[model samples]
Target: MAIGPSAVERWLDLSTEELRAQVKQLVAARLPGDHSVWQAIRRHPALVPRIRGVLSGLAASAAGSKDEAMQKVWISKARSALDQEYVAPVKAARKPVVKEEPVPEPEPVIELKEPEPQQKQPHKAIPTMLFQEPS
Candidate 1:
């Protein structure tokens, strides 16, 4: 349905939070204590504009009537619009984290060796005897 000029002006004038507050107020007024629709809207809040559109359509069609039946109808329409506009896709669950085991340290090594013995030589004294015999 085409949005009215006043609706466009109202939407442009209000902040996002204000618009949401207005939607929440309307939902609360129509369906008091019903939180499923509001919870869905809170989770995927981008659907606020769609909910506003549905509300505006209801207002335009009803022309400022405060009838209980009509308000119930508006609430029903708003819930359905929220459901259709913000259906979330199924997401995969996250995996658990794993811890690694600590490694053991190596042992120190040591070695020992014995020293070697030295050899001795003997001297000859026959030079004096040879000289005396020659004399």
Candidate 2:
């Protein structure tokens, strides 16, 4: 069955539990070996329902075809739908993007100064005498 925008919107309106259930059903029906998708659904229990309609539609479409090629095609379509509807959008939303402008380097400045003449200090002569025996 073809999933339209309205169907997706309706799925988006479903409760978290309902969505989770829908995804669980889809996993059981169409993706038994897809542990990663199952793990992701469990991890983001809240997000699973968001793609329920697409996945459900894909699963339904794949249900009629017993051909291995057609089943593979449906699985691929479901995977893409899950990525587009759920994974990619969430990843994009969660990514922290920092936009920074390149700053221009500052030019170095050098200053020239004249050297001052050194001042001579008067030196005191050391006391010649060793301490006289204290009288």
Candidate 3:
């Protein structure tokens, strides 16, 4: 239920001399990224080291505090501000074009031949009707 200053408010509260000292400490620690406090640094995101130093100092002070949960909340907010600061945006990626190849047609494997139909011959008449009677 404790209310406190925001990260921007805390940063803005620092005296010029204190900010300069923090920036120097960051440089001494060989922290990467921009340490300058200029507005231009906000656009391209180069001021990480400077603010990170401030966060470190804040953590040291909060370590001995009675309210550990509140201190963690404050630190989380400050970190969130650092992470969400102005920076160069990522560009959309484009898909690469793929070339198509022509496929060859396959030849037939098995061959079959069919026989032609033949006409049927007529049957010869029998001579049974010409038999002579024995009188």
Local distance difference test, per candidate?
Answer: 0.54, 0.53, 0.51
- Per-residue lDDT tens digits for candidate 3, residues 52-111, read 666666667668679756655655655554565565557979978878787877987876
Please, what is the TM-score per model? 0.27, 0.25, 0.33
Superposed Cα RMSD, model 3: 21.5
Which regions of candidate 1 are displaced past 4 Å? 1-29, 64-135
- TM-score, structure 2 vs. true: 0.25
Error of 2 at 47 (Å): 5.3
- Between prediction 1 and prediction 2, the one with superior TM-score is 1
Query: Cα lDDT for residue 82, model 1?
Result: 52
lDDT of 2: 0.53
Distance (Å) between predicted and true CA of 104, model 1?
51
Superposed on all Cα atoms, the candidates' RMSDs to the truth, in angstroms, are: 25.1, 15.4, 21.5
TM-score of 3: 0.33
Error of 3 at 56 (Å): 1.3
Better of 2 and 3 by TM-score: 3
How well is each residue in 1-135 modelled by candidate 2, as lDDT tens digits?
A: 222233333544667666645554554456533344544553454555555454556556566566646655645655654554333334445768799999998988978889899999989889887777888
